[model samples]
Target: MEEKPFLGLRTVIYAAPDLSATKAWYAKALAIEPYFDEPFYVGFNVGGYELGLIPDASIVEGSTVSYWGVADIDKVIQRFLNLGASIHTDIQDVGDGIKTASIKDPFGNVVGLIENPHFSL
Candidate 1:
C-alpha cells in the first residue's frame, strides 16, 4: 500500500458565548455571509476553508489557534487590526522566509496569519 499526503486545512472551530453576535461580527470582518447556520454551529466558507463558530457557555480566552494564509503579512495584520482585532502576536519571521502573526478577535478567538513566499496553491 502507498501512503498519501494529508489533505489541507478544512475547518477551524472557535467557541462563542453568543453565537449569533459572533457570527454577525465575523460576517462583517470577513465580508462574507455564512453558508451554514444552526442553533449549535455557524460556518463560513472562506475561500474554500471553513471557519466555524460553535456555542460554548464555558468559552475561555485564547483556547485555540488556527493560522490563515496571507499574501502580505503586514498588510493583512493591518486589515485585521482595522476590523477591531487586537494583536495577540506581532508579525515576525519564523524562518525560511516565512512570516506569521496572530490576533484576538472581539469574541476572544485567536486568528493567526501566515505569509510564506515558498507556499502556493
Candidate 2:
C-alpha cells in the first residue's frame, strides 16, 4: 500500500448571485485574479487561501455563510452591490475599528463581511 500525502485546505465555496460579475469584482477588490474559473465555479488565489465562488441560483436561498475578517469590508460591500449582491446588514461601526456587514449574493446566499482593526495586509 502506498502512503498518501496531505496538504492544507485548498478552497472554500461560497454561494454567489451573479457568478461572472462576482468573480470580476473580487479580482478588482482583492487585486488577485482567479487562476481557475468557469461559469459554474469561480476560484481566486488569495495569498495562501482560496476564495471559491459557487453560483447557486437554483438552490441557494440567500446568504449561506458569513465570511468575516475580510481585508476591506467597505470596499467589498460596495463591489458586491455593484455586481448585484444584496445587503442583509449594513456596514456598522461596532467598536474597536471593526466594521461589519451582512450581505446576500445574487443567488440568495447570506455572507458576512467584516474589517478588523488589528489585522494589517
Candidate 3:
C-alpha cells in the first residue's frame, strides 16, 4: 500500500491589510507573542502549529476553516468576541461530544475553535 502523502497541518496564514493592528489583536486573542516578527510576516507558535500573518492589500474570509483545539470552546469564543471578533458560527456539537465554532477576526479571517473529547497528541 502507498503511504499517506500528507503530513499533519503545520500552519494557517491570514492576510492582514493592517499588519500592526491584526498582529496586536492576534496577540491578545491567542495570548501569545509572535516568535517571528517582520514587515513581511508575523508568525505565532500556536500549540506546536504556526499561525502566520502576512501583509496584503485585500482580505476576505474564505470558506475553508481550520479548527484549533480548545478545552473550553465557549470560553474561547467569548474571549474572541470580547477581543472585537464577530461570530461566524456559534458553538454546536457536530457529534460524539465534539463542539465546534468559527469567528471572524478583525482582519476578515475566519478562526475556528473545536472542543473534541477525542483529540490528543
Candidate 4:
C-alpha cells in the first residue's frame, strides 16, 4: 500500500484590511479569541482547525469555499448572520445526511459550514 502525500484541512486564511475590526468580528462570531495574534496575522483555533487572518488592503470574496464542520447548520448560520455575515449560499441538503452553507464575512471572505453525519476524524 502506498501512503498518501496529502494530509487534511489545516488553515483558511482571509484578507483583513482592518485587522483590529475583523479580528473582533471573528472573535464574536466564533465565540473565542484567536490563539495566535499579531499585527501581521491572526489565527483562531476552530475545533482544532486554523482560521487565519492576514492584513491586506486588497480583499475580495472569491469563489473558493472552505467548509468547516458543524453539528447544527441552521443554528450556526443564524449565529453568523446575527454577527453581520450575509448569506453567500443558503443551506442545502447535499444528500447522505449532509448539509452545507456559506456566508460572506464582513471582511469579504466566503466562510463555509458543513453538517455531515458521515464524516469522522
Candidate 5:
C-alpha cells in the first residue's frame, strides 16, 4: 500500500522536567487549560488534539522534545537535518495513513515529526 503522506499532528507527549513549571509555561504561553486532570499526567486540549505533558526525567533517554505535525514530512525533516538535526530514524510508513520520522535535537532529545496525509490523524 502506498504511504498516505499527510500532516496531521494528532497527539504528542512532552517529558518535562518540572511538571508545574511546564504546565504553567504552556498555560501562560498558549492560554489554554488542560482537560485531562491528574496528579502525574497533564493533558492540554488544544485545537483538535491533546498534548500530553508528563514529567519524566527519563524518556527516550532523558530527552524532552516532541514535535506536533508538519504539512510536508520530508521537507520538514530535511529542514531539521540541514540545521544539524541528527536523524535517529528515517521516514517510515507505519500504516493507516501515518508516516513518522524521528530525530535527535541538539539537546539530546528525540523529536518525532509526523505527517498523516490520508486521514485526520
Candidate 6:
C-alpha cells in the first residue's frame, strides 16, 4: 500500500484577540476545560481532536473554518446560537446525507459543524 499522506485533522487554531474571554467562551461552549493554558495559547481536547486558541492582536479576517463532527447539526447549531454564536451558514444538506453549518463565534472566529452518516469514530 502506498504511504498514507493524510492521517486526519489534528488541530485547529483560532486567533483570539482577547485570550481570556475566548478561552472562557470555548470552555463553556464545549463543556470541557482546556488541558493547556498560558498567556500564548490554550488547547482543548475535543473528542480526540485539538482545538487551540492563540493570542494575536493583528489577526486578519476570514480564518480557516474547521467543521467539528456532531450527531445532530440542528441541536448543536441551536446550542451554539444560544451561547451567542451568530450563524455564518444555515444548516443545509451538502450532498449524500451530509449536513453542514457554520457560525461566527463570539470572538469573531468561524465555527463549523457537520453531520455525516458515513463517518464514524
Q: How do these models rank on lDDT, best leading?
A: 6, 4, 3, 1, 2, 5
Instruction: Using TM-score, give the best candidate's number.
Output: 3
Query: Which stretches of model 4 miss by more than 4 angstroms?
Result: 57-63
Q: List clash counts for every candidate, in order.
A: 0, 12, 0, 0, 4, 0
Q: Which tens-of-lDDT digit does each residue in 1-121 have in candidate 4?
A: 9999879989888889899999999999999999999999999998889999988645434536889999999999999989899999999999999999999998778888999999888
Cα lDDT listed for each candidate: 0.85, 0.73, 0.90, 0.90, 0.69, 0.90
After superposition, which runs of candidate 5 have C-alpha atoms over 4 Å from their true positions? 1-67, 118-121
lDDT of 1 by residue, 1-121 (tens): 8777877799988887888889988998788999999998899998889988988745444556778988888987777788788999988898999999998888778899999999877
The residue ranges of model 2 lying beyond 4 angstroms of the native Cα positions read: 1-10, 16-32, 38-41, 54-64
Cα lDDT of model 3 overall? 0.90
The TM-score of candidate 5 is 0.46
For model 1, the stretches where C-alpha displacement exceeds 4 angstroms are 1-5, 57-63
True lDDT of residue 21, candidate 5 = 68
Prediction 6 global C-alpha lDDT: 0.90
Report the lDDT tens digits of candidate 6 across residue range 1-121.
8999999999988889899999999999999999999998899999999999988745545667889999989988888889999999988999999999999899888888999999997
Per-residue accuracy of model 2 over 1-121 as CA lDDT, tens digit each: 8776857446556766678877776677567798888888888876666778877755544425545567778787887788777889888988999888888766555667778878654
How far off is residue 40 in model 6, in Å? Answer: 0.5
- The ten-residue window of minimal lDDT in model 3 covers 56-65
> Model 1: which ten-residue window has the lowest total lDDT?
56-65
Model 4 TM-score is: 0.91
